[model samples]
Target: MTVSALTRPGERDRLIVKLAELDWVFILALCLIAGAGGLMLFSIAGSSWTPWAINHVSRFLICLLMLIGLAMIDVRVWFALAYPIYGVGLLLLVAVELVGDTRLGAQRWLSIGGFSFQPSEIMKLGIVLALARLYHGVSAEKARLSWWLLVPALMIFLPVLLVAHQPDLGTAMLILMTGAAIVVLAGLSWKIIGAAVAAFLAIVPPFVMFVMHDYQRQRVLTFLDPESDPSGSGYHILQSMIALGSGGLLGKGYGLGSQSQLNFLPEKQTDFIFATLAEEFGFVGCVSVLILYAAVIFMALRTAYLSHSHFGRLAAAGTTATFTLYVLINGAMVMGLAPVVGVPMPMLSYGGTVMLTVMIGFGLVQSVRVHRYAEVTSGKGSFV
Candidate 1:
């Protein structure tokens, strides 16, 4: 064997030391947020772990392990797999169209044996990875041109069209917005961006009327005036707003929110989990969770800024943007400021897949944090 082969174990040992140097503050903040979710889920379940709390805790532990494992792997490994992962994610979405589970009136889940998952969720990370790789090889001059822009435009558009076909507009919008963010971060010109935004605005009303499914159109209408159908199509927004406002300053106390404990709030365990927390713990608790989320984003953006590679920078920043959208969309949805979009509040929501996807993204952020000084180039990563 060559000398490099003989010394591979030493290189592995150095990576382990780097793992020990991972940012604990970020990890601890993550745990606190997850812990807060458990408490709220407990309340949402009428103070029983039988339904939600225990599972939330368990899934968080598993995802935490996954996070650390991914963090230990060299960024080059992620770099090499980026496009393939994106390709696989695309295939999974296509497969969903073929034989996906139809649940809650949306065909977004794919079932395998006993396990079911959402491919759109995977695309959230896949888009970030793929676009990061694309832009890593791009120059600012190329990024500025219209023809060269087709590369990223198609990368962002294709999955978006598929996900929207699933009629999962929530996740579709997420992918679209996050992908655009990566394109912007890739050094797109303001002239191009402005024209694009104008084009989107110009087409939105017609698109909503013609292109949106009936339920999708209804959601927009409901957002504009939830009272229009308070007992029917607007029930979720109405109940969530009631729960949110009733909490007052100090809240009704845990397990005692009338809207939730009485079973008026829809999907409280998942999409409306933030409202569950707010109803039980009031304004103070909501602010606390937001602060935790802000800290995570701040650290992630900081990690991106310190990264030596463009992939690391864009990947971290894109992941951060997706997460920020999760918070904004969910927070607004529950407050009746926007349409109900079924976005979970990171670890705070009781869905296993969403939690797993978020942790996987963080694992990449942690990779950037641990190896921020490490440099990699197009088509190759430095071994040491």
Candidate 2:
């Protein structure tokens, strides 16, 4: 083979160069996190890939492709599709109400062509995009306590209510926080922010007393005192705490975590997966993993800060907030610091839908990076 022939470019070579514009650091960080997930899954499967490991890796690879494809598209396309995507997400939420699948006494899952789908996951992104799109055109001056705020408030609350209706409080809280952050970023005044905070604090008591279901109320009570029950509403937390504490500084080694290996840990592959990691890998492993997540959030926030376009800024920041909240909430739950709300440990937790949504968000973040110069203004006329 001639060197000239090897160096020559065709469509495929050109495409490769184009895709290389992507931020490789962020991509590598994601791969490392996913690799940790696969390893953890393997450990959970008794040092095998037959069950969770291979599936997690395969899903991650598939989602990585989706990420690249999304990155390659014009972010303006994302901006333009924001509201439409939000609308579709809303419809899916409605579909869940009509014919949705139920698991664990919660009507949150949806079935589509033999695939388990969750519309609330989609709304996580859709709401961010919609808020970004909504505030994209409006001047910051008009966003603060104006009648214009009503539309964005509705955009947020509607999905939040729908998700809450699914009884998926974790996801609902995620959506609500994402919307609130975007509005704040859009420059909602501090006075309004303070009042909103006060209002939320004011509502918590009544909401917990009157709004929460029996089990949900039990969870809050258990969070307050897990030792009180030890084996009922508090079983998961107590067991998780024991496993975490037993891991000590260096952990029990892979596939040797007594809690999981001895069948003492609950939800080893899902919500409490972090506890499993802490059990096997110990505090050092957990901290190392957290540093990685911190780096990811830092990069994401930096992307948002640097993007000239308001849409890119809001979407990127909101997505980062979602990821951060997921990690924080799940970590706290496993460590007995917060209520167990079924929030997974991001890539470390096994879930096809959440993985896809996270990767897609990073893909959009990469788009912001690559097309940093490709600015789009706020308004319908700016849509491409």
Pick by TM-score: which candidate is best?
A: 1
The 10 consecutive residues of candidate 2 with the worst lDDT sum are: 375-384
Where's the lowest-lDDT run of ten residues in candidate 1? 375-384
Query: What digit string (tens of lDDT, one per residue) describes model 1 on residues 89-175?
Result: 999999999999998888989888898889998999999999998888788899776698988889999999999998889899999
Error of 2 at 54 (Å): 0.9
lDDT of 1 at 24: 86
Clash-forming residue pairs, model 1? none
Cα RMSD (Å) between model 2 and the true structure? Answer: 3.4
Clashes of each: 0, 0
lDDT of 1 at 161: 95
Candidate 2 lDDT by residue in tens digits, 1-384: 777776777755866865877877888888898999899889888888978999999999999999888887777888988989999999999999999998988999888789888899899999988988888888868888787788988999999998998899999998999889889988999999999999999999899999998888889999999989987888999889988998899999988888887778888899988898899999999998998899999988998888888888888898898898889999999998989998999999998888988999888888877666677866662544
Query: How close is every model to the real structure, measured as TM-score?
Result: 0.95, 0.94
List residue ranges in candidate 2 displaced over 4 A. Answer: 1-17, 381-384
